[model samples]
Target: MIHFFKQDVSHIALPEKFTYPFHYTPHPLCVLATGEVKEYIAGKKEWQEELATGKMFGVLVVQMPQSTDTGYLAAFSGNLAGKNIHSFFVPPVYDLLQPQGFFKIEEEQISAINQRIDELENSASYLKAKERQKVETAKAQATLNQAKAGLKAAKEARELRRQSSLALSEEEQAGLIRESQYQKAEYKRLEKEWKRQVEELEAEVTRFESEIERMKMERKERSAALQERLFEQFRMLNAKGEVKDLCTIFEETVHKLPPGGAGECALPKLLQYAYFHQLKPLAMAEFWWGDSPKNEVRHHGYYYPSCKGKCEPILQHMLQGLEVDDNPLLDNLHKDTKLEIVFEDEWLLVVNKPAGMLSVPGKADEVDSVYHHLKKLYPNATGPMIVHRLDMATSGLLLVAKTKEVHQHLQEQFEKRSIRKRYVALLDGSLSDIEKTGRISLPLCLNPLDRPRQMVSEEYGKEAITDYQIISVSNGHTRIAFFPLTGRTHQLRMHAAHPKGLGCPIAGDELYGKKAGRLYLHAEYIEFRHPIYGDIICIQKEAEF
Candidate 1:
């Protein structure tokens, strides 16, 4: 049963079998255990109309009976002056109608609701328009910037061409020459800027092409589509269509580009194309041929350079290398240590290698290396043999053999896994498992996507095992002792940082861990059988932590 009034707990007894209609929200109101009595605030027109029989602003008291489920519906039909007020007792009813006054209140409520909806719609529209405008504004700005650069370049180029023309009178020609030189300087500056832009574009293209090649080899159609989408924007910039003649156009455009002209050098453009195509073989050949070579051919066995004496002229005139040869890398490493020996003996030598020092010589920069250092130290020897390697960053315990026989013996021991190597590492997070010891059996494989990162894979991977124990923990850092079963490049370090394992990345491993500093892992101990003495030998150095 439903009752309507204002603020009373008492109920008058009423009969049943009567019904009335009422409007209500579908949401249920929580009925207090003690029963709540309140004025029925109606927002529906039918409810308001029912309540309007009485004065509009007067209060209606309600009673929620404590003893029964059904209660009386009474109407006190006049003001409190006792002016012929009518009293009525209605039977218990479930559907009650609203008074006329309540109906009017509902109509106004609906109008307010509609206004709110309109406001919300306007707000939504405004936000959408603002976002669209922002996007368009950014696009317009970018377009303007590009146009400005192109126009400036074109204007400068035209001016230079005009000045270079010989049709002007002598006085005018002198003025033109002066103007041309100034413009030429400006053009060179612009050319440098253009070169920088081209380099950036080339790098971007190279990365894109590398990704594409990787995707193609894996037969990833979706990846290829994504790659094409990224290139679409680039194609618009370059005014390119289809992939055919792309290299040729790029090369020609770059080549025809004068030093300060509106055009760019073709070398970068060609390199970018070759990088994208992974035409490394051809690219390498071109690079080896230097900037210019009159005649060059790659045959089955070797490369042939028949320059028609053009190469000699280039070497003499263009390169200016007649008196001295300059290698920039060597120039960068021009120090006494590059020539001085760290440690040398007739049998073996150890070197304190500075960073950027190669343990052995590469094909190109074959001048400065440990071999060079050793060669300089031992003039009578043929070539020093590198027994093991410490990466350019690692600065201690590099072993080299002077005699071929000794080198072969030392190499055999390393290859046979007869060396006991220990590394000290400062790792991320405090050591939780200081006494715990277990073998990490995850197989290691070089990352196909990023060659520099090694991944743990289940298939097509080689077995890698590292035994690590926490030595000490301090300052949220754990010093760990590492021993490897297999000598994989970056094996122990990679395994330690694996998320499922300890999750404590080695300090100084910027690629694998938070950039704390340099790589904190140091090879502090190496034990092996000595070649000359038929006994085991151990070498240890103080921690460089």
Candidate 2:
């Protein structure tokens, strides 16, 4: 559905190209559209609680048909209130929820199969076979044990006869040997008879198991086919009027199959309707509308980028023939910035690394890193001069080793947690709920769906602990000092943003919070025992922020 702007947006200049979707600043028109969509959501009081539990909504600012006016289209990702169709929003690319749809029919078939499988597993015949097998196995073992005991008693009696003092003929000794051989043969026969009886019960159980396995295999195949067919239904359109389904788009990508919830996101839906109805897309923005996810950090009403795992391949095709903004991540901003050395010695040195530079060189062509800069300074430095790493956006002290031996020694200290680290950060929100000083113990792990981004996952995460003390509070922002007891990827950021911890993300944290001019986190202090000098080594640097 197309909704025209109620207020005057004529003074705002239109964007030259569409929003990049992955990383962008919303255009003035897109911002206005976002505000209007928010008001509409608020007007629906019935949906308030559901919306508060987290949902992603997107808006696309478009040029309406045959009119010199600009308007927008709104959509919610996936479904809302157990339904896909709703008022004032674009319809799904493929509505699997429709009663007469093939997806629904096939889904019911699958459900029926599942129910049948359950029935067979719990059937009296199958259960009887399993019980028979168990009872037969135990009887077999007991019979074999009794037969062995009888044979051992017979052998002992034969040994007693041989040990007697009476002088016996060679024929008597031969008779005793023959008796032992006959007894052994009888035991072998008994063992075989019991084995045959036990095997019959096992065979009956195996027959039932084989049928269950066959049904399970069938279930898996049908599920795969249904998923593929569902993906084929999502035929998306581009500005050039080109159409492609989810399967074809993802087949061209590294992942040859569409991920779950691929074509249902708000961005894809909004673009699909715009292209089908001949609306010219100007810019677009997606935002979180409710509570943060359990494992991820998302603030209410905050703008977010379209997820890469699902939408990247689809949007790559949909945005064709439309000019889009340049990706800001690829910008090489370290050309003129200087890498400053704060402390130096023959064994090691400390450098003040600037923000927006990688700790180590990445795959990018022009991006500079602290490791490369350090290597340039110490041309003959031995064995991977960089000792530790900091997040690219974090600015401050970085320890570097001049020799391989020193590097190894320093690395041991880090592994043993002998090194003390302190960081200064500015949290976007005030710390009214938490104490002035406290410890945050939230486990962390990488978010595989969104690489380089970390999440708090108690189920599959490593121990990440941080002790913090508030330095000051002003302008609704809290300046804090963090003392990390364990080194983990994005430990500080996850602790700050996670609901179980401070519940306030670090200021300008693009991965966890809002994107700003720079991330307001700095590695300010480090302490360790010198590898060669056998003395306490301490270094501290102040943050520019």
Candidate 3:
């Protein structure tokens, strides 16, 4: 699967360390290799339409041992064109799709179980038994009801006869009471008989269902066991030649079990082959080559980091014993940015937060944040000084409270949605068909696999609404104003990039759009009530871009 480099690259310097897979700037060699792979895919017109649906491909630049030959390996996530054994791309760690593999053999048995379940569910005998049970139960209930009604009428008649007999003789009254007692005894007998009939009918139905239930239980157990065994077969390799299966690797992580499709990603396949063949890996990169997914924001040919949920633990094991670059997330992104105070009073202040600055202290031993800055400025400020937050990539106006009481009041206003916010952003693409004004109501939730990234999810997302007005369209870019009625994380970004909404990503939005000098979104205006003064207040800041 090694394709030797055709272009001369002797002048380019090699990286001092391996590219960190989780987050990276693609190396020059990797970029060259990715371009070649893309060219090959493009020439294959047979796969063009299917591949236009979207796929992830990766390249691993490796050095052949004791030789000057420098070639790269290519891999695609999962299978291409329904097969994992395609030429040029590396094979999977364990080909579960192989016809003779244990996974397939077990899968057939599971399929049989499923078929049997369907047969039993639709069997004539089972259906007939169910129908009979329903009908018989209804008949039994109706009989009991009719008997009770007859007994009630008989009692009424007995009472009338006794009342008339009171003027005649005591024996007559005694006879009427005896008749009432006999009628009650008959109703009791009929009720018991009907209950017995209903029980028999229910038992008949249970007899037909018992086998199907047992088969379903067996299917569940066998499927779970088969999946665990499949994980065991996927043994991974590290640069040191150490090995760990999927189960063992995931057990060491916070998620104690491997997620589905854990070992099939392009990153894992590339490294697995590199280690298996004794090649020394120097650099790697993964890029999306086709259509962007519905929920995520992806640009064609743009390089992206490996996912966290599936690849993080696997990469942690596979990358051992190699000199890798430190994670960039731990570094401060806005060390030179300074917070600008926009408005201030006895209780609170509004500051213009620069893009890339954190609203509060973050993990990875980062202590520089707006909250910490306020602490240094006020020194004696009480409670949490930071009243609200903005995405690190977004420049915005943030409210800061000086006292605990004031913070509570501001929080209450936010909860009641009395605080109004307006943002201005420049989209990377022009929206020729978009109306001048509109409302976008796409729901959003954090992508479980990728932290801090939001996705459009109608099923589990919280309601996020934005009203937008197109400001101007110029040079293939659209500038718009966003009035957010909800403050979910990344709500505005998701609404803008999602295909069902604006279908355009904001300029320089590294997570959703092409990376540039900075994100082109800004909180330009806000209106709120003063917490202490009980007076309406408004603030405005012009975007630098």
User: For candidate 1, lDDT tens digit of each residue in 1-545?
Assistant: 13332333334332121110011111111122112211232322443444333221111112232333322222221122222222321111111122343323544454455555455444654446545555655655575567568667766775776678867677875775676567657656765665565555556445545544554444444434433332232221111212322222223332321111111111222222322332220111110111111111111111121121111111122112112223333443623565333455567665545544667775656447776676766776544477887654444556677788878888888888888888777887786754566667767777543334567777766888888877878898888888877877567667777654566667755445543435677777777676787667666664656
TM values, all candidates: 0.40, 0.93, 0.94
Give the runs in model 2 whose Cα sits over 4 Å from its true position: 65-67, 164-175
Better structure of 2 and 3 per lDDT:
2
Whole-model alpha-carbon lDDT for candidate 3: 0.88
* Model 2 deviation from the true structure expressed as Cα RMSD, one decimal place: 2.3
lDDT of each residue in 267-357, candidate 3, tens digit only: 9999999999988899999888778888787778878888888998999999998999988666686665577999998889999998877
For each predicted model, how many residue pairs clash, with residues at least 3 apart or on different chains? 26, 0, 0
Better model by TM-score, 1 or 2?
Answer: 2
Higher-lDDT candidate of 1 and 2: 2
Go through the candidates in order and give each one's C-alpha lDDT: 0.46, 0.90, 0.88
lDDT of 2 by residue, 63-163 (tens): 98788688999999999888899988999988999999998899999898899889989999999988888988998898889989998999888878878
TM-score winner = 3
Which 10 consecutive residues of model 3 have the lowest summed lDDT?
328-337
Model 3: residues with Cα > 4 Å off, grouped in runs:
156-170, 335-337
By lDDT, the better pick of 1 and 3 is 3
